[model samples]
Target: MLSAVLLSVLAVAGQEPPRDCARPNGHLETVACYGERREQVEADQRVILSRINARLDQLPAEGGVNPQQAKQSLEQAQSHWAAFVAADCRAGEALFGEGAAFALDSLDCEITHYQARNRQLAAFEARYGGA
Candidate 1:
């Protein structure tokens, strides 16, 4: 009986306690880290979207842009944003213990990235003649 009890205690002890992302210092640190990464992603998206939009604006109303070129530029920007977001989210999860704040912050970063990208595309269309 004693041996069984000892084994049970050992098993429980071997399991690590859940991490608390809400702890004062940890919570603050996590938020700051997420914020920094989010800002970077947002900035990059802004640049891409601005360029795309500028290009689009230059296009003629009668015919649409060159499907191939527009598609290629869009795909490139999207892929970059997606990868950045994914990596950021993963890092947040790892560092923040999947807390609600962490999730929301990460999502905000993604939204910002998309919005910026859209604007960038518009800017790009304006700068260069669109197909």
Candidate 2:
């Protein structure tokens, strides 16, 4: 009964077949899943950033915020955000220590950050768009 329930949960969470993250059998499997997820999320971040940059380029200077200023601001904000993600994730991982829960928790933490940042960026684009 437990196995069936777990399997269903995994299936709903992800198919991650290539890395078997949905039903990871070992540490390596989870590691692979985390790496792949991180890469995919980072790629998404890059795409959104490109879109934001294009939008910034289109909007004229307003309230002393120009394209160059917006780009520079984004770069600065991203640097701080990247650092925060790293520190927060690492601290959580360290507190969790090495175990069955470690990788999963770490992965969840990372995904949460990426998802939150994406949402924030989307909202910004929808709103003022740094203009």
Candidate 3:
């Protein structure tokens, strides 16, 4: 199944995810995969936010919202989003109790949240990013 695909990936024309990370060696490695995913998503989101923040600094105030106020609002939204992700993931982990799956579930939840947030940020840039 997954093992066969992982083994054959190197022989195929296209590249594939690393065998250990894709299939995972154990629960620990399985959790590590989520960590890697979270890192990638967060890194992407950071770049987007940085660009938006820079734009905010350069642009003139819009409507009643000044650049500084907009940045502060963004900061607050980001902080609230982070808190929600943490609390929700902790709740998910609680459902699984003391087991290897609990940690994996929590990490998976965080990755899902972060990925969704990344998409939202990208869409924001696409809509509002001025040249």
Best by TM-score: 3
Give model 2's TM-score versus the native structure: 0.71
Instruction: Tell me each candidate's TM-score.
Output: 0.41, 0.71, 0.78
Each model's lDDT comes to 0.55, 0.73, 0.73
lDDT of 3 by residue, 28-93 (tens): 556556666766887888999999888888878867758898789889999999899888887886
lDDT of 3 at 75: 94
Q: Write the per-residue lDDT of candidate 1 for residues 1-131, one digit (tens) a residue.
A: 12123234434556535434455245434444344445566676667655555655565555664745665677786788678866765676566565556554555555565666556655655556442
Candidate 3: worst-modelled 10 consecutive residues by lDDT: 1-10
lDDT of 1 at 85: 61
Error of 3 at 17 (Å): 15
Candidate 1 stretches with Cα past 4 Å from truth are: 1-70, 129-131
Error of 2 at 96 (Å): 2.0
Show pairs that collide, candidate 2.
Answer: none
Superior candidate under lDDT, 1 versus 2:
2
**Model 2 C-alpha lDDT per residue in residues 10-126, reported as the tens digit of each score:** 566765656566887786566556656766787888888888989888877888767888788988999999889878888887888867677667777877899899888878777
Q: Deviation in angstroms for 46 in model 2?
A: 0.6
Q: Please state every model's RMSD to the true fold in angstroms.
A: 14.1, 8.6, 8.6
Task: Quote the positional error of residue 19 for candidate 2 in Å.
Answer: 4.2
Number of colliding residue pairs in each model: 27, 0, 0
